[model samples]
Each structure stands twice: as C-alpha cells, then as structure tokens.
Target chain A: MIHFNDVTKIYNSNVKAIENMNFTVEEGELVIMLGPSGCGKTTLLRMVNQLESITKGDIMLNGKSVWHSNKIEMRRNIGYVIQSNGLFPNMNIEDNAMIVPNLLGWDRKKMRDRFNMLMELVGLNPDEYRKRYPHELSGGQQQRVGVARALAADPPVMLMDEPFGALDPIIRTHLQEEFLQIQKELKKTILFVSHDIDEAVKMADKIALLKGGKMMQYAEPARMLNKPANSFVAEFVGQDRVLKSMSLYTVRDLANALTLKPVIESPDSQNINENLSLRVAISKILNQEADQLIVENDNGTRKGSITLDLIEQFLHREIKESV
Target chain B: MCSGGDLIVNLIEYFVSNFTFILGYTWDHIKLVGLAIIIAIVIGVPLGIYCSVNKYAASTILQIASIMMTIPSLALFGIMIPVLSLINEGIGTLPAIIALVLYSQLPIIRNTYTAINNVDPDIRDAANGIGLTTFQRLIKVELPNAMPLIMAGIRTATVLNIGVGAIATLIGAGGLGGIIYQGILRTNNTMILAGAIAVAVLALIADLFLRLIENLFTPKGVKK
Candidate 1:
C-alpha cells in the first residue's frame, strides 16, 4: 500500500509542480495518475520513488515513511519504469535486467535464475534477447526490457511513467494487454502515469485525473467516464466519454444486464464474448441477420437476450448523458 | 659498390658500440612520456569533472588554459626559464616535464568535461531513480560512459607529449632528441634520421596501444 498526505512539490523558484495532494492505493491495485501534459501527474508518480522530493508532506509505502527509509533500499524494493525505457546503453539486456540484483549482491546463480525468469515474464526469450544490446531492439521490445529490468528484483510496488507512450498504436495495445496479464499474476501495487485518456481507462483500476497541479477526480474508470467531476476532466477526457466508457463495460456488463428469458443463437455468436464492448454489441444487432444477441454468463451459460432496441436505447442514452 | 659496403659496415659498428647508450636513452624517453601522461590525467580529469559540475569555475579555468595554449611552446619555455630558475638554476628535465604537462592538459580537461556533461539526461535520471549514490553513479555509469572520449583525449595528449618532449634536448634535458641535436651540430644526416624515425615510431606505437585499450573497454553500443 502507498499513501500520500498533503504532498507538494515546488521547483527551483516556487513554480508548483504539485500542490497539497493526498491519495492512497491498496495492495494489488493499479492506480493511474491521468492528466494533461505538465499537469503534475508525472511529478506525483515520481514522488513514489522519491525521484522528485516532496516539499510539504509525507509519503508512506507499506506503512513506513519513504523519507525516513534508506533511499537505496527503498528504491530496490520498488520497481520503476520511465517513458524512455531507461535501460543502460552500456549493458546487454541480460545485464540490464540483473542490475538491481547485482546491487543487492546476489550470488551468480540467483542472478542468472532471476534474469531468465524475468525475460520470459516480459515475453522476451532468454537465449535470443539476453545478449543483445538495447539499440538492437525495437522501441516496444526495449520498453519490455525496461519493464523486465524493474521487475527482476521482484519488488512489491511498481511505478511506471508512460511506459507505452513511445510505441506505435498497435504495439502499444499489445503491450498494454501483456502488462495487464502480468499485473494480474504479479499482484504488485502499481502507479502508472499517462496523458492518454483511453489508455487510462483501459489500464487503470482507479484513475486520478489531475489538472494544473491539482487532482480533479480519483475514482474507478467507469465512474470517471460516466460522470467526470468537473468541466476540466470532461474536456480533458475529450468528446468520447461514451466510447471511452465502452472500455469499462465488458461483455460481462452487458450479459449481467440481460433478462435471460429467451435464448437466441446466431452464426457470428462467437464474435461477442464476455469482453466485447457495447458498441460492438450495437454493431452485431444492426447487422440484423439474427433477431436477438446472445449474452453468456461467466460460467458460459446462455444467460439471456439483448434486443436491438435495448442496445440502441443504451447508446442513445449514453450519448445524451455525455453531451 | 665497395664504398657503399664500407659505409654500411661502419654504420653497423657504430650502432654496436653505442648499443647500451641508445637503448637506455630510448627507455628514458619512453619513461618521460609515460610519466607526463599519467600526471596530466591525474590532474586534468578530476579538474574537468569539477569544472563541468560548477559553471563559473569551468569558464575561468578554460579561459586561462586556452590563453596558455595560444602561447608558442618555445617562448613559453623561454619565459619559464627565469621563473623556474628561481626554484632550480640548472635547466633540466623538470622544466621540460612541466612544459609538456601544460601542453597535455587542455584536451584531457575539455574532453572529460564534455563527455560527462553530454551523457543523456534520461540515463542519468534513470541512474538516480535506480538509487545509485552520486559516487556510485560517477564511478560506474558516468565514468564508463564518458571513457571513450576521455581516452581519445588522453591519446592526443600522449602523442603530443612525446613530440614536445623531444624538443627538451635543446635545454640540456637528455633523451633520444640529444642524438638529433648532436647530429645537427656535426651535420650528420644519418643520426638525425635515426632520432626522427625513433620518435615517430614511439608516437605511432603509443597511439596503437591506446586504441587497443579503448576498443577493449568501449561498450558495444557506443562503438561507432
């Protein structure tokens, strides 16, 4: 768990990067600090690792004050990834992954074991990638190494600052999916920073929307999308709240809403699963080859039917609410 | 043909007779160049790092060094003769060493400062974020990354020092250049060629050795 109590950061001559911020993240939860450029989101993420010192209040990790702990030890216990994928150019991928373990003075065997395991975890093959220099890898691959390097020491807390921001859109989406899978298995407390609202909605369990050094809203992604706390958040979230909200509503949400009285089967039924969006369901309905859309329960039972009119009504209502 | 044969024999005999002296003189020249390089690096590198860390100090020190570099070597030595005579009247190896040290300082200082300062700010920030102390970062990351440029500077200093050190014989400092000066007074072209060739070879060998060392230590990513 991490807790921030009235934390503030003032730059060289009183330019406030962040002002009197307070928040907490539970263990195994992914909290994203979402905001515009220069909105103090990155500053807040950096403070978790003490990369940016706080001028005013206390930041505690796992019930201890971060400032009071030995900084090197604290850093070793927290995984940090930056936008540029900060792998040391002087080191091969294997050596980069081994850095923290080497710093902790682990034995040779332990280091190699940890290195191999992390390489696999981040989707890099140990034999093919371990000896390659960072420049030889693509941007997405380098970012994976950056993430793997951070995870090598198996820290309980991970802080990522726009780790996928530099990748192409396709690679970014792939990496985001891989990262979500990793986070689910690792169950590490994660604080991510990104300026993209869609990325925040897709990746964050809780989103902290910040603007002008102040946090405008901190809530679940669905709530933030359905109802922004202020005009700044709404505007920053852009004109696509309903579409962004689709990321939060899994096919499961739609399935849960189904009445279950009638069963409808179609040839394209597999296209709609527990993870399809409402927009996808609306498309499936408009195709009109089938009378009703089948909704399945978590256990794969045919829960109920979602009519074309019902999905259309939901989309219309969402669009009206967003306006 | 007989005259040429006789000249070759005479040359070989002369070389055999002075074999030990020639060997000892060459060894001493090597020692002088080596010592001067070590001293220059010891004094210049840290000074460069300090200057890079502090803005005003770097500007002042570089300005002074640049002014010193503009002074002709012979005149600088001539001016130093009186000043250095106050400490020791006999003009010898010490004055020569001091002059070469000055000549070598600029490249080492400038390259070290530039290399450390030019390292990617993101890399440095990553080092800090990873919790390396200032000293650790300097020793492990900054120094290693900056080394190729620093070594290039040192290489320039080494070759320059040897070339300059050869001129020391004019002031009674003994080295292989003593042979050249003696040859000049006697108008002996053979001896002059021998000295010049030896100095050239010494500079080339030193350069090749440093290049090998640089290659051995340079990180693969920065190797272009």
Candidate 2:
C-alpha cells in the first residue's frame, strides 16, 4: 500500500506544485491522477518515487517513509515509465529490458529468463527484437520496451506519466486495453497520470480528478460519472456524462435493470427494480417485450413490483430535477 | 634551369631509382604520425570523459588545455628546448611528439565533453529510474551515444597531429619532413614537394581509416 500524508511540494522559488494533499491507495489498485497539463498530476506521481522532494508531510510505502530511504534503492523498487518511452538510444531492446536486473546483479541466466518473459508479456518476441536498437523500433514498440524495461525487476508499484500520450489514437486505444489486461494479470499497484479524461475513465479502477493542484474528486469511475463532486469535475468529465456513464456499467448492471413478470397471466405483473434509475428502467421496459420488472433481494427472492406508471412518474421527476 | 620535359623525366627517374628509399621514408612518416596520435588518444579520451562527468574539474582542465593550445608550435618547441636540453642535449622527435600531443588534446577533450553532456536528459532519467548505477550508465549508455562526436574530435586531432608531425622534422625528427627541411636548405624543390605530398597523403589516409572504424563501431540509430 502507498499512503500520502498531508504532502506538499514547494519549489525552491516558492511555487507550490502540490499542497496539503492526502490520499492512500490499496494494494493492487489502479489509481489514475487525471488533470489538465501542468495541474501537478505528474508532480504528485513523481513524489511517490522521490523524484520530486516533498516540502512537507511524508509518503510511506508499505509503512516505511520514502523520504528516509536510499533513493536509488527506492527507485529500483518502483517502476517509472514516461511519455517519451525513455529507452536508452544506445541499448538494444533486450539490454534495455534487462537494465534493472543487471543493476541488482542478477546472474546471466536469471537476467535472460526475466528479459524473455517481460518481452513476451509486452508482446515483443525476443528473437526478433533483442538485438534491435531503440531507433529501429516504431514509436509504439519503443513504448512497449519502456514498459518492459520498467517491469524488468518486477517492482510491486509502477508510476506511469502519460506513457501512451505520444502514440496515435488507434495504437493508444489498443495499448490501453492491453495495459488493463496486463494489470489484471500482474496486479501491480499503479499510479497513472493522463490529461485525457476518457482514458482515465477507461483505465482507472479509481480516478482522482485534479484541478489547480487540488483534488476535486476521487472516486470509482461509476460514482465520478454519475455524480461529479464539483463543476470542475463535471466540466472536465465533459458534456457526455450519460455516454461516459455507460463505461461504468457492465452488461450485468444493465441486465439487473430489466423488468420481468412474476406471472405470465397478468400483463401489469411485469415490473422494474426500484433500485435502478428510472431512465434506465423505462428504457428496459420499452426495449424488452416484457410489461414490467420484478425486483429481487440479494438471495434472488422476489421483493416487490415496479409498475410502468411508477417508472414513468420517476423518469418525469428526474428529468424535471435535472433541467 | 631544367626544361619542363627534363623535369618530368627527372621526376620519373628519381621515383624509379629511389623507390625503396621513398617507401621506407613514407613508412617512417606514417609511424611518427600514427604513434603520436595513439599516444594522444590514450591520454586524451579518458580525460575528456572524466571532464564531462566532473564538471568543476573538467572546466579547470579545459581552461588549462585551452591555454596550452594558444602557444604557437614553434614557440612551444623553442621553450621546451632549454628545459628538454637538461634531460637530453639535442632536440629531436621527442619535442615534436610532446608539442603535437599538447595541441591535439583540446579537440578531443572539448568534443568528448560536449558529446556526453549533450545526450538527452530524458534518456538519462530513464536509465536512472531503471536503477542503473552512475558507472553502468556511463559505460553502457552515455559513452556509446557519445561515440560519433568523440570520433569526430579524434579525427580532427589526428589530422592536425599529422600536419604538425611533419614540422617536427625541423627539430632533427627523421621523417618526410626532414626531407622537406633538407630540400629547403639545399634549394631542391623536388625533395620539398615529395615531403609535402607524403604528409598530405598520410593525413587523408588516416582520416578515411578512422572514419571507417567510426562507422563500424557507432550504434546504427545514433546520429553521426
């Protein structure tokens, strides 16, 4: 677990990059720091790695103060990937990937095993790419090498500063999906920074919306979209809250909103779950051939009926309130 | 007093008769220039890398070397003569080698410093983030990236050394330059041209050879 306690960073000249920030991330969670450029998202991420010193307060990793630790040792244990895919120009793909392991003095065979595994994980075949230099690879491939290099030592935590920000949209989307898949398998705690809200929404298990170096909201993607904490978050999340909200709901949530009849004999016996938002329930009723949805308890027993009229009244009230 | 045809015939006759001597003289000129450059590289490259890594020390050393470079070669040799005479009476190849080495240090030092310093900061940060020790980063990344630039400096130093090495013949250094100096004293233009041409050819050949080596060793992605 990583914990930030009243952390603040003031530059030597008195500019505050971040101030009075406190947050904690559970083990194996993907927490994104989302903000516009220069909003201190990058600075906050750097603080975890001790790349930027804290002006006040402390950051602890697994109950040890990061400030008191040896910086090189701390850095070795934390994987950091940046926007430019900072693979050394002189090193070939395999050597770049094996950097940290080599530093820790892993023997030749162990290093080779780790390098090959990481290359395979990042979708680079060792035989084809091992000897190729940085410039020989494409931008996306270089980023993969950057990510592979970071994971070489298998650090429990990763700090990514817009690692995919430079790639084209198509490649970026593919990489994002791949990243999520990798996260699921590896379960490494990650603090990702990105100015793109949609990416934040897609990739983060939890998103922290930042503005002016202050966190406006920090919540799960569903809650952030359904109820933004402030105007800044709402605007940053943009005008398509409904569309963005869809990403928050899986097919399971949509399935739960469907109206089902308890008995085929009675037309009004069909009902929607009252717990579901009226707009979603009404859409389910209209879309499905069923007349109503039957609400159920946690044990799968029927709780009550949600009539079409009730759903209509609920939708009307919600629309009026939103307007 | 010789006609143009007579001069041409004389040149061909001279070349045919003295082929062995000319070849031997050319070999001696190459040896002198090549050895001086090797010595300069052996001393200068590491100094350049060291200076680049240690800014304060590098600046002080560079300042001293720059000052040394300002002294004229002839004046430097003249100054060295009295000091060197105490060690060994006659001025010879030693003074010339020492002067050329001093002259060649600047380009190698300056270029190496700039090359290592100019590597992208992001790349350095990446290496650091990945847990590369300072020494590992220097050996594996910084030096390799800095190669082409360092090589360029080395090439400049080498050619410059060869040119200066010829002038060393003025101080009892036996090479093609001795031929030139002797020809001048004797008013023989043929000998002067022979020595001048030999020195120029040596410089060209060394430059080409080093260039080939540079291309062979430099990482493909690195800009030359």
For lDDT, the strongest prediction is: 1
What C-alpha lDDT, on a 0 to 100 scale, does residue B219 get in candidate 1? 88
C-alpha RMSD values across all candidates: 3.8, 6.0
- lDDT for model 2 comes to 0.80
DockQ computed for model 1 against the true two-chain complex using alpha carbons: 0.66
Model 2 residue B169 lDDT?
72
lDDT of 2 by residue, A1-323 (tens): 78989988888768888878888877899999998888899989988887677889999887889878888898999989999998888778887888888878899999888888888888889889989889989999999989998898899999999999999999999889888888999999898999888888888989988877788888887678767888888898999865565454433343355443343446654544334544455566677655656665456666555556654444344334334
* Residue B147, model 1: Cα distance from true site in angstroms: 1.5
Chain A of model 2, TM-score against the native?
0.81
Error of 1 at A74 (Å): 1.9
Write down the C-alpha DockQ for each prediction. Answer: 0.66, 0.56
Binned by DockQ into CAPRI classes (incorrect, acceptable, medium, high), candidate 1 is: medium
Distance from true location, Cα of A273 in model 2, Å:
21
C-alpha lDDT (0 to 100) for residue B134 of candidate 2:
84
